[model samples]
Target: MDGTALLRWGRVCLDDLADRREEINALNVFPIADADTGTNLLATMRAAMAEVRTRGPVDALTTHDVAAAMARGATLGARGNSGIILSQVLRGIADAVRGGPLTALTLRDALRRASVLVRDALSEPIEGTILTVLDCAAASAASCRDASLADVALAAADGAAKALGDTPSQLGVLRAAGVVDAGARGLVVLLDALVSITLGEIPARPEYSPRASVAAQPVEDSGETGSAEPRFEVMYLLADTDADRIARLRARLAELGDSVVVVGDGEGRWSAHVHCADAGAAVEAGLAAGELSGIRIESFAQHGREMASGHPLAPVDSAGKLDGPADRGVLAVACGDDAAELFEEAGAVVLAGDDGVTAAELLAAIRAMPNREVLVLPNGALPAHDLVAVGVAARDAHRDVLLLPSASMVQGLAALAVHDRGRIAVDDAFAMSEAAATTRWGSLRAAGERALTMVGTCEVGDGLGLVGHEVVVIDHDVRAAGRTLLDRMLAFGGELVTLLMGAAARDGLAGELVAHIGESFPGVEVTVYSGGQHGDLVQIGVE
Candidate 1:
């Protein structure tokens, strides 16, 4: 394809996708089912088109220039998990064709390369997805190496269509929902668009819809209410790093979450994505690897209604707007339901969830706050960069945002204990900061895997106790580990000990600790709470 042809293909595909966006979205049930696959693909294509359009008239650009622009644009502007993968497909085509004319051999090479790129980008490629459809298309094109361009396009589209049809059988989620894969259907649309541009025909394919039996079923199980799956989708563009750093980032992201994809534009620039419960940690990983831009974190539970309505969620701004910004409001990032309740009951606004809060989310919350001076208790839920981003952005919008350096739930609670809206902003900030800094904290985790730690090597199921991020005690019995951890923390003398029990904490774990503290550490106060946080069995705070 020449520059003109490339631009035409992108335009055709964009229009086709726009026409089918709703249909594709309706079919999205797998992969957390925020139901925005169609929207994501359309956004990605628009980005590609925008890039090539900036290269002057089609006549001014070579085939290579257009291809490269499309790839770069797609990579930079890719949205969501599906969009990132689609960007990789574009990158593959660009890599294969360079500036050469699109012949049968080149078309075959493009499809093959696209498939490989897509797979390589994903941390864990699954079957019955866009990957499968793209793979089938590539394999089909490869088989028709000697065919004409039109024939190759036709073969690839046909293969994608066939694969789309069989997706329900290959994937249990699709089979249960009685619909073809949403992403696979999208790939077929792109391939059919290619066929249209090359062969002047768009293949007729069967429409896919959720069966009546499953149509009313929940598209996703976990959400704002709570879910078993990871809760947040985190994406960002990373630059100023290398392959080695990107490799390490990929491994780190996989450890933190799922549906991980990190793809480069063949240049140093890369698009990184992950679906994780801890949105903060995901972005932090990217930050550690290199400079990051366009950081976006989406909570799945918070996405569906807005997406379905095709609008940004209206911020809670009616009262704020009418009354103007009030004297003060506190925005506390809480990791669990109980923690959220505790924060809210303390007269502070709470950003509650383990899904991790992003700067964008923080800014929105800040804008929605009725208070003129907003105190943010990050509570370890946001990275330093995000804090800076939100602070700058909030100031730009004329809101005063004070991000307290609280690094744990315990610290956040400690800060909240001292927040005085009646005090001046600077004084309040200092008081809260002081309270947070003085609160010593630690946690207890049930080791999920055997690993060497500061304490010693711990086996799976063993209890590991951490004091300020360092594991200092490992015991076969979690209860014993908890006691030992408390002894170490209280050895220096503390007036009060707060124990926050996690979701999976034993029934009598807190009571046992409280009783033990009463007997062993006489005159010290003990307070316990059901934190409901994940990963940790219990979080400890000493004051």
Candidate 2:
């Protein structure tokens, strides 16, 4: 096996998959529920990259070692149903290649084994998932009985592509959702990247140029003299004793700049780049991490002016301005329009969609707000990391930003309902949001193969009943599920119950759920309303 080729292929796979993460996430029919397949795959691939980095060199890595590393990475990092399936596929490949030299023949056999393992693992294999793609790839490879490694890989890629293209036709849910098989598509991209890398067709990196000269153009001789101080751009690596402490240092860097990129590992290693007027402050922040290395600073004012004269320079700072109101603003990261409007009506300036909005965006949003303090609501489980990232960004920017950990749509709605604009302090809003959030339960329908979770044994088509983080029930009948879920909600001695049914559930099941809730939870006033979206789903809240 060519070790260098292996690593190159892995990198290619990750880059290709990363490029389409948003598309994969959007393919989710139940957008409000779970759509983390892409994110989970990216995270899993990132873990694999870390393991690859630890390997002594391309030459030192045996085929077995590479396979083992990938399997371990996937096992530790995989998330959601799709992620687990992807991981299992990798595991199958690893097991098949465990005692092998990994030539074209071994690779072909491995692919076959991977397909079989995945199909067996799934209770009911769907036609538009990673499993389908892998199965097709294996069959294609097997068809070429006398092919080279490269030939087999190419065949596999082609087969995966064909499988991905057929996803819409194979799955009704995918067709209704207006997306090709997201998981299958992602897998095909990953395979294509690997094939490209194996064939040595890596793209070139652009040259880096300074940006300060272009940004520092002087105005015409108006009586006032402009400051001649050169704004500096700095890049450095910091090693901290503790990761949390580095977060505090990041908070300090936010006050100094326009472009700030602070990326740190949880294990005390950090890399940062910033374009700011005060280079010393940036350096000081790095010093807080204990020691610094590869420190480089250049004046950007001159570069900015040069760029203004039609000479383009590389951007100095990748981190754009924080997004929020200048005086009073709302920062929310959520999926679905209804969720966004809930926050908007609660006086929040909503950032629509999931991608492009990072921690820096949150900080920018908070800083842009007119009020000294800003409130942030992360309306989903996946965006929680981004919210934390924003918190760190806010702390670095020295902005008063409050993050309410609302894990579901219902909780987010509840939090918005109790938001008090008059309360300037975060503690006040935090208390109220927390209380309001507690009054509601978040329920969602499960997708993909059924599995026994910490919540319970959930099937793919079952309606999932969630009270907080625990999965209380999974049932086929919508009304029965709603009634059982409501009973669980009312057990807490709630006086009122509200059911917000999704657009899909409105025609058939919403009225039934309302009737059931009214009957089951005696003396508990039940209210049923449309979730105001198209979907055969319903949200039942017992207050």
Candidate 3:
């Protein structure tokens, strides 16, 4: 198939699957009720689609490029167990078809290899799961002697469907619960959707009607209307860079506008999304030392009109216009709902962006609010660069803005806890930034690989304990790590210790950790609370 044709097929399949996500989500029977199989799959595919659309169509497009893009999307957008598995499946296919224009035989071999690769990637393969269904489907496809692409996909879908039906019977848990294997069923639906799309059957759009009544409409041509038409939406990736340079870049972007979203690591490679008028300037600014890829520019004026007419874009801007008292307004950029809620509770308006937010997006969010003056809190180290972009956008828009360099969530929370609401915006920003920086922050995260860290030699999947910017401990037991972290905090004469337990660690573990701290340090007060959950893990923040 041609490159454009392949992309079209992928997109159509994605749209079909997206339409039936709720049905796919309902199929979960095992691994408890908090299942996000369908949602995860959709998100993973959407990420790939975004990249595909950004790259557009090229005459000499190689399968390698397509596969590489898909793999990149999967890595970044992977969420749950099912999502990770699906990503691996795509990665395998990409690996198999690494050379060029795909023929029926190459495609079949890719599917066959992908099935095996997916199974190998999983630690334990269980029957009546997505893995089994995919394995059977691939076997069916491989056995066909003269199968075309359509024929292979149809056979694969058929095998998957049968496997899904038998899942309840194969697994005792599923039989007892009288429900099908959720993950397996979701995978079947995805494959079936792909087949249907290939056969020219398009699904209907899913309804998103909520139970709550709609609020009164704002005046159409009021002062708020112009703000809705943000001039531009900009996105780019930075090459090789450091934190100090990134910080300066952020300060520059901050002057642009309110809806800024700069996301990337400090190691020279970064991506940013911003909504502003001067997108050219924004792209030009990031061109220093790094080659920009995947640049996207959208006109919000046309976008807002489309939305008003019932064609809403993706839920990118959840934070509505900023208005009301300017004593302290928050400007935060984060991706997950749990993270956003954490900042919201700490008296800041949360803007959703993973890693970092662009200056244009930040400026747009700020300008959307009616407030004339505001304080920005970039909670991640990498996002600190966006503060500069926000400032630049703000100055161009003639808005007063103050940036509080709250480099991490811990610092942002601390600063919010002691914010002086009565002070001027500049004074409040500086004070909160300074206060947030002083609080000691540590995190317990799983090691991605077995390597020698600053703390010591650590194995993959081990719990890595970090104190501020330093590595302190690496172990397998989360509880033990928490205890060690608490002891270290107390050793620093820490009077008030707050343990923000992640969902995984929220099963009365925090109380136990607190008790351990209490026994170790008699005078200090320790508080335990939940930090919510995101993806497959929990986060416990200690202050």
What's the candidate order when arranged by decreasing lDDT?
A: 1, 3, 2
The local lDDT score (0 to 100) that residue 103 gets in candidate 2 is 64
lDDT value, candidate 2, whole model: 0.58
Better of 1 and 2 by lDDT: 1
Q: Which stretches of candidate 3 lie over 4 Å from their true place?
A: 56-60, 197-431, 434-543
* Candidate 3: tens digits of C-alpha lDDT, residues 69-174: 6656754555455655666566665666667655556656766776775654443355676778888877777776686666776777777777777776776655
Report how far residue 156 has shifted in candidate 1, in Å.
0.4
What's each prediction's TM-score? 0.60, 0.40, 0.42
Q: By summed lDDT, which 10 consecutive residues of candidate 1 come out lowest?
A: 316-325
Candidate 1 scores a C-alpha RMSD against the true structure in Å of 17.7
List where candidate 2 sits over 4 angstroms from the true fold. 1-327, 354-371, 381-385, 395-398, 455-457, 527-529, 532-536
Winning model by lDDT: 1
The TM-score of predicted model 1 comes to: 0.60
Model 1 lDDT per residue over 139-258, tens place: 999998667899999999999999999988877777777888888888889989989999988889888778888887875432222224687888888888998999999989988888
Which run of 10 residues does model 3 get worst, by summed lDDT? 215-224
